[model samples]
Target: MSEFKQLYKPLLDGANWQQPDQLGIEGTEIGHWLLEQDSLSRRFQRHCEAFTVSLIEQVKISHAALTNDERALIGDEDCLLRKVVLQGDGQPWVFARTLIPISTLTGQERDLEQLGEMPLGFRVFTDRSGRRDALVVADVGTDTQPLWARRSRLWINEKPLLVAELFLAQAPIYGKEKQC
Candidate 1:
C-alpha cells in the first residue's frame, strides 16, 4: 500500500458523486472537462506550452479495498491502482487515479502496466474500440477549498478500467479565466 493511496482513497470514497447536470455545472468550463468525450491530455496539450505526466505510484490494491462501485465494474478482483499527476507548464493541474483489474492486463493490454510517464489517454484513446460509461462528477477536498473531479469507466475491447481525475486548486482552469 502506498502512502498516497492511504491518504487519498478516503477522500475519494467520501465524495458525493453525481451527474454534471445534477450539480449545475452544465455550461461551465469545469463542466466541459468533466463531460467532454475528447482526450483530456490532448486538450491540455493544446492549451499549455508544455505538458507532462508524472507518476506518483502504481501498486496492487486488494479486492477488499475497492469501493462498491469499483467492485461492481471490476468484479471484486485484485487490481493495479495507478496514481499520477498531470502537469501543464510546470504546474500541477490534475491528479488522476486509475484502477486496472489484473485480469484485464493480458495480450496487448499488458502494455498498460508499463506506461511509465506516458499519459494514459495516449494509450486508452488510441484504440478505436474503446468507449466510456458512468461518467459522474463531484467536488472533493475541504469545504473551504473544494476541488472538482470526474470519474468514469473506460472500456477497451470489452475490458474495464476505472479512471478518476481531480482538478487541483492550482489547475489552470481555476484561474481568473479558464487558462487551460
Candidate 2:
C-alpha cells in the first residue's frame, strides 16, 4: 500500500465520513487563522475544508485502463475519489478519501457536447474482437471532443490508479420538426 493509503485507512474505518469543504495549511494565512481559533473541533473542521478544495483542484487520476462507457460517465459529472497529502512538522498526513459522484447529463447530444469541452486527456482503444475502451487523465487542458465524436467511453486515473468512469448511451436525435 502507498503512503496515502496507509494514512487514510484509519479515517476510512471511522464513522464520521463527511466530505471536506476546505484545505488547511500549516503556516499560511488560512492555517494561521484556523490555529488561532479556540476550539480543536473548529480547527479540525477548517482543516478538512481546506483539504477538500485542494483535493478537487490538485488531485489527478490517470485513466489508462477503463472502458469507453466509463469514460462517458465521468465526462458527464465530477464523480471520483478526492485525496490530499499534507506535510507536517514531523510527518506527512494523508486526508480521508471520499468518493464523490459526478452529475449525469440528461440528453445524449448535450452531454456529448459537454464532454467535448473537458480539459482532461482522453484516449480510445479497440480490441481485435471490436471491443472499445477509453482512458481519461485529470490534468489541465485535456480535450474531450474526440471522445464525444467517436462515442467512446471514459476512465480517469492518477498514479496508475483508476479513479472514475463515464458511460454513454444511445438516444433519439431530436430536431425542430417534432414540436407541435
Candidate 3:
C-alpha cells in the first residue's frame, strides 16, 4: 500500500473520522501543511463559510420561536451553534455544527484561535457501486466537542432513509508493521 493509503486506511475503514487526543510529530506537521495548501482544504473552507452563513440565517428566521424577551436576553444566539461546512473539489460537501453553551462563550471564542485548522485525519467512503468518495474536514472545536447525538436530515433527500452524523473522538494509531 502507498504511504497515503496506509495513513488513511483506518479512517476509511472506520467510515468515521475521530480526532485523537494527540497526534504524532509527523502527523501534526502534515496536518499543518494540508490546511495551508491542499485543494481539499480550500474547498472545505469555502463550503464551510457558506454553510455557516446559511445556518445563521436559518437560525435568525427561526428566532420567532423565542419570545421577544428571550431574544433580548440571548442577544446573539449565533454563539450557541457554530456551523462549519466543507466541500472538497469534485467531492460532496459536508456540513458540521458545533454547539456551544452560553456559559462557556469566552472559552469558545478562544478556541476559534485556530478556527480553520485541520486535524491529522482523512476519510474516504465507497458507495455500493464501488466508487470512492473523499470526505472533507468540516470543523474542529476546542471549547467543547460537537454533539453528534442527532442524526442530520440533510442526507435524507440525497440518500433515502440515510442519516448522517458527526463523531468527535480519538482516532486509532496506525502501527508501523500494519502500514496500509
Q: Give TM-scores for every candidate, taking all chains together and pairing residue i with residue i.
A: 0.89, 0.23, 0.24
lDDT of 2 by residue, 92-124 (tens): 322323222333222221232232212222211
lDDT of candidate model 2 versus the reference: 0.26
Instruction: Compare the candidates by TM-score and give the number of the best one.
Output: 1
Model 3 lDDT-worst window of ten? 153-162
Q: Is candidate 1 or candidate 2 better by lDDT?
A: 1
**Clashes in each model (backbone N, CA, C under 3 Å)?**
0, 33, 1
Q: What is the lDDT of residue 83 in candidate 3?
A: 42
lDDT leader: 1
lDDT of predicted model 1: 0.83
9-125 per-residue lDDT for model 1 (tens digits): 566677788987899988887777778675788878877788999899999989998978889866889999999889988887887899999988998899999998999887888
lDDT of 3: 0.27
Say which prediction, candidate 1 or candidate 2, comes out ahead on TM-score.
Answer: 1
After superposing candidate 3, which stretches have Cα over 4 Å from the reference?
1-79, 107-109, 113-180
The TM-score, computed over Cα atoms with residue i paired to residue i, of candidate 3 is 0.24
Q: Report how far off residue 56 is in candidate 3 (Å).
A: 7.1
